[model samples]
Every structure is written in C-alpha cells, then in structure tokens.
Target: MHAGGIGAPTIARTLNEEGIPNPTSYAKLTGYSWHNRPSSSLWSAGCIYSILHNETYLGTLCQGRQLTPEGQFHSKKNIPKDQWVRTVGHHPAIIDDELLRRELKARKEAGAHNLHEQKKNFPPGIFGKEVRCASCGKILTKGKTLRKTGCERTLFCPTRKKSPSHCKGAFISEKHLESAILHELKNLADRYSDDRVQIGICQDAQSADLIQEKNRLKTAVELIEKEITAYEQRSRDLYLKRATDGMSIDDFNSALSRIRNDVDKLRLKSKRASSELLHLNESIAAESIRMETVLKAADFNHLDKTKVSMLIESVYVHKRDPKSGTQAIDITWKF
Candidate 1:
C-alpha cells in the first residue's frame, strides 16, 4: 500500500475490511508467547505505520534504541539514533533497500507537509513548556480559535486526542492562565513584603541548621576515611607479621580478611556522607538563587514569557468540575 502511495490509515482500513488477522492475532496463531492484548482484534493506523518504518524488514538488526532506567521498567526513553546499534544484512531481507528508502522518503515528505499545516493552524504559544495536564503530566499543546474580536489562544492536553481516558477535559484559556499567574504573583509578593522580618528570622534559623548538618556530615566522612586508613594499615601490618614474625598463614589471612571487610564498610559510609554533603551544598546554592528570583518577581504587575520562566517552574491545570464549572490550577514556583 505504501508503494502504491496509499496512506497507513487507508491500508489499515483495507486490511480490516478483508478480515485479515492483526500482528497480535498472527503471533498468537503461530504459537508465539504473546502476553498483551490489543485494544481491538484489528489492524490500526499506528501498527501499519510502525511496520512501514521498521528497518528490520530490510535485513537490518537494531538494538539499544531505547533505555529503561534502573527500577523504571515503564519509563523507556529513546536513545539518539547515532547511539543506536544497527547491523545491516543481519537477516534475510523481506523488503529491498531501494523500496525501504523510497517509503522513508515519501513518509518524510508527507510528515513535512502535515507539520506545515499544523504550524499554520496552531502557532506556538508562550506557555507551551510551562503548562501541563495535572492528570497525565503531559505538556499542554497550544491552539487557537478565531473569535469575532481576535484569535483566542488555549493550552490543552494533547493526550485527550489520542487517549481520552487518560486526560479528559483538560483545557484552559491562555487569558485565564495569565490572570491566575498574575494573581498568584501579587499574593506572593504581598506575603513576602508583609512578613519580611519574620521570614528573615526563620530563614536565618534554617540556614544555621543546614550549616550544622553540613558540618556533621563532613566530620562523619572524615572519621570514616580515618577508619578506612587504619584498617588498611592493619592489613599491611598483618602481612608484615606473616613474613617477619612467623605468624601462621591461616591467622594472617583471617586478620587480613577482617581488616578488608572493615575497610569496605568504612568506605561505603564515607561515600554516603560525602554524597549527602554534596546534595546539601547544591540545595543551599539553588535556594539562594531561587530566593533572588522570587524577590525580583514581586515587582511584576504583568506577565511575560521571560518573567514566567524565571519565577514559575510549572503550571498544572486540572479537569474542570462539571457541577461548579470551575477548574483547579496549581502553580509550582521556583522558590
């Protein structure tokens, strides 16, 4: 179908119309150990598109294309194409290189055309990165609608278009978001200004506590290091006693093993303490910088992209309540 200039969706529809089994069904029929069930026992545009773009049919083996970080089986992140391990002619070719190249080129051209249309329909908005869907945590995409007065902008969860069950009714007007941000900024500024002295006193106490903790961690690390050194020295002494003092080989080995175990434990303790101190220092530095930015944001009466980026970390918009017709907007400030 791709060779005949038929799109993936049309190909999927044709396959379903002919009552052909989808990949999952085919795998199950062929006695493959398939575990996951498809949403429907039918071909989908996504499945068709994936098959069309796959290089494996061209006798190429690709691995390490994605990575699942330690303990995060579900959060697979794509590695860069340059880093992906690919071996050509690793298996019998089902599709010729020429055919695969042509299909890829055609798909790229089609994608470019679709992207142009999308850009024209939905020009980028200021809060594209900063706004998110509270339910799915996906970045809200910018869109616009033509009103009688002008083009009205909105930030909406794009997941609703693909998976409505995940992020339903996640939409907010850009104007409404700006108003909320400005209001929050005003409130924050008033609070800071009104309780400056009390805040300073509290912060001073916190700073002292952090300093004390940092010192304690540093001391612990130093002590652990010294203990490790002592164990190493004892090991060396045992070796000398075995050679010069006629110490039994078994006794020497036993003492050396105990010393090595103690050293390993002390080194682990030292590493933990050092890591804690490093984190504490980083937190102190970040807090100082954030406080400066927060104070600067106090003077902002109107919102701009630059000021928003400086002060706001993220803005999560929850689904609107059907009864009250109100939505919850949660803002995470840098400070």
Candidate 2:
C-alpha cells in the first residue's frame, strides 16, 4: 500500500476499520508465542517495513537463521549469512514476483532519498575488492564499455575520474580478468600436486620438509630428555656409593657436579628444540589448510564471491597492451 498510493497511517487505520488482525494478534490467535502485551497489537510503520523485507512471503523459506546453542531460543546469536539455508518455492506465494520487485525498488528509492545511490546497471561479476589498479592503488569499480560489437563488462580505476594525470586510465575487461585469475589458480593447484615440480615452487614439497624438520627436532628433544634422566640416575648412584664408602667424598662431589651441569645443558637444549618443533608444526598445519582451500577453489567453473574471497587477496591490473590488446594482471593469492 505504501508503494501504491496509501501511506502507513492510512493503511493502519484501514486495517483496524476492517477488523483485520495485526501480526501479533494474528500470531496469538494462531497459537504462536508473542512476548509483547496484548495492547500493542496495532499495525504501524515499523510493522509495514518488517513485512516488506520478510522473505517468507516471496515463496522462499529461510531456515537455520538462529544459532540456538544449548537450546536457548531467546538468546540472539549472530549467525553468518552464508550459514542460512534459503529454499525458494518451498511455500505458496502471497504476492506476485513483479509486484514484490516494484515494492523493493520503491523502498530503496525512499530509503536513499538523502544518501548516495548505488549503480544499478552493473552486469553479473564477482570481482569485489579483489580487483585494483596497479598504478594508483585504488579499487576498480565495475562499469560497461560500449564497443562496435556490443556492450562489454569493464572495470575502471576510480581515481582516474578525479585525477586523470595520476593514473593512466586503468581499465580492463571483466572477461579477461576472470580468465587470468582462473588460469593462475589452476596453475597453483597443479604446481602443488605435480611430483615433477621443483621443491622450491611446490607446496607439497615445502609441507613435507616442514614435517621432516619437526620430526627431527622432536627426536632431538627426546634424546636430550633421556640424557637428563640418565644424569639424574648417575647422581643418585654417586650418593649411594659415597654412603657405602666405595668412592671418596671429593670424587663423589666432583661427579655429581659434572652430572648436574650435563643435565642443565640438556634441559636447555630440550626447551629450545621443543619450542622450534611447536612452531614448525603450526606452520605445517596452516600450510596444509591453505593448500586444501586453494585446491577446492580450483574446482569452481566460474568466479563467485566465495571463490574470490578464498583464493585471491588482490589483483593488480596493469595498463593494456597496444599490440596484443590485452592487459597484464598479477594475482596475489590469499595463502
């Protein structure tokens, strides 16, 4: 009604006049729980806004929205957007899709009455913050390029619009950028998995070397601990021999002093070795997870938000080549 001609107050008054139940009143009559008092069941602008934004009426049902740990329903848990399951066409639609779209558009215009409006003609692409200009170090915003063939998706450096002299008009086609990124990702995955690759460039080889180093350090630590134990036993034996008069007191004291010094040295070596081993192990684990993530990303056929966020840190777009008519893109991996 707000999108049509009626205002919020008029809509509320019409609902009350027609004896139609508001949300809380309807929910209460339908056996649903409403914590509010019965006196506050009248419709208002806030209620209208909530109804307009709710996805349930658009033939979609969203589940797993609440993270109810320990079965506490009242506690508000901030669940990530990705974790929510949305099932489209799971229920009957109360409104047509076109009407819903118009209402949404209207609401957006109303909300942005005093704010900067977003560009609406952007084609489908997944390069959010990942794409940037190499010359100016600013994000490349998406726009369309009109060519003799047709319209092609393009990205431009925002700084070029303000200070053209600062940047040499950094721009590139989305198709070329995506192809470069996908090629680089696939190359990385292949390099890690190929046994013929050099150890310096191979992720698997680095991981293996880290594991071997960690194991060697662990073994060294164990040897040092055994030596410390042996020294402690020898000191005990020296004390027993002194009591039995098998050796002189001065000789026993000298042996005990040497054994104690050896034990101290071995303890220090063991501490250092253990610390190094712990750090090496952590590095190995992190590298393994990173490799797994990259390999999983290589399975994607096209770019998406998830894949871009997981695989790419940033893409530097160099100036286009005049002869080859292709821009050089340097992709920095997240790992």
Model 1: CA > 4 A from native: 1-126, 129-176, 186-209, 239-244, 309-314, 318-327, 333-335
Clashes (backbone N, CA, C under 3 Å), per candidate, total: 0, 0
What shift in Å separates residue 59 of candidate 2 from its native position after superposition?
52
lDDT tens readout by residue for model 2, 240-317: 888887798788788888888888888888999999999997787677676666677777778877878877888899
Top candidate (lDDT): 1
RMSD of 1: 13.5
What lDDT tens digits, residue by residue, belong to model 1 across residues 3-47? 888876677767776778887888888999458654455676688
Which pairs clash in model 1?
Answer: none
Q: What would the C-alpha RMSD of candidate 2 be, to one decimal place?
A: 15.1
| lDDT agreement of model 2 with the native | 0.76
lDDT of each: 0.77, 0.76
Would you estimate the TM-scores of all the predictions?
0.46, 0.56
